[model samples]
Target: MAMQLPTCTGIRIRSMSDAHVIFHAVTLGILPIVSRRLDIEERRYIHSGCVCVWEERSAAGEGSSVTGIERWTDGRRWGPSRVRDEFLYYQEKLPEFEADEELSALIFGSRLIKQTYSVFVDTPTGRRKWHLGTSVRLRARARFYLTLICMAS
Candidate 1:
């Protein structure tokens, strides 16, 4: 059975504990793509975001929709560079993934694994949402940290 991590209910970047979960995950190299955005130090300051494991599917069963695992991000203060850097880093990481046929096939051959990020900014009219990046992790290493945090609350 696939292990299920605790879900994030209304999590945001303002929460220190929630942000730490992402930092810790990146520090451990749990999500190679996400980790590429940081220069070791920046990872420490990424204190506003929630991580979610999502499964994409198609209702028609035609295999036309995205499938497999995905990491979704909803954060505050994440900049364009952060997401852009990660996308570029994936290019370098692609070669290494060749060893894993399943992962390589899904990522290179098919578009199963994907990522979507959104940033929230505070404004006079409350929080404004900035939708960013439609694109496309780990063997639950990151999930473990998130699970702990979820269970605590």
Candidate 2:
């Protein structure tokens, strides 16, 4: 089930079906970044297949997954320094905008807030708890984003 990854030059992932390979690639490329954070440049890299996820086996035969941008569209290898430079470049290029506190809260809130509300329950106490948890999460998230924004500024 080994196949050559077109995006990762001279590298092949062993014992992976086509579906697994594609799943890994897509997950690696998209899951880490929120959809709202994805810009045109990120979309271009994703659609052009510049991302790769490969499995590496340790000496003890335990396998681990490695995900990264192995190469650029122009076939240049993305070493650690290259990746860091690209990240810094994008960070600098981000346009300044008024940060929406509520939106930032929703984005950064814990999944526990959603799970607590998702349970099928009609008790007033349960509803109250859920609302309380949601508010706390949102407030914490707002504070976190504010700190980051302040540091960046």
Over 63-119, each residue of candidate 2 has an lDDT whose tens digit, in order, gives 232221222232122222212211211111122346599865454352111100111
Task: Find the 10 residues in a row with the least total lDDT in model 1.
Answer: 85-94
Which model scores highest in lDDT? 1
Candidate 2: worst 10 consecutive residues by lDDT? 127-136
In model 2, which regions exceed 4 Å deviation? 1-3, 7-49, 61-153
lDDT of 1: 0.35
Clashes of each: 3, 0
Report the C-alpha lDDT of model 1 over 1-153, residue by residue, as the tens digit: 333332232343333344446434533546322311223443333322224422322234434443423333322222233333223112113333435777665554432122344444333334333222222133232454688899999
lDDT of 1 at 80: 31
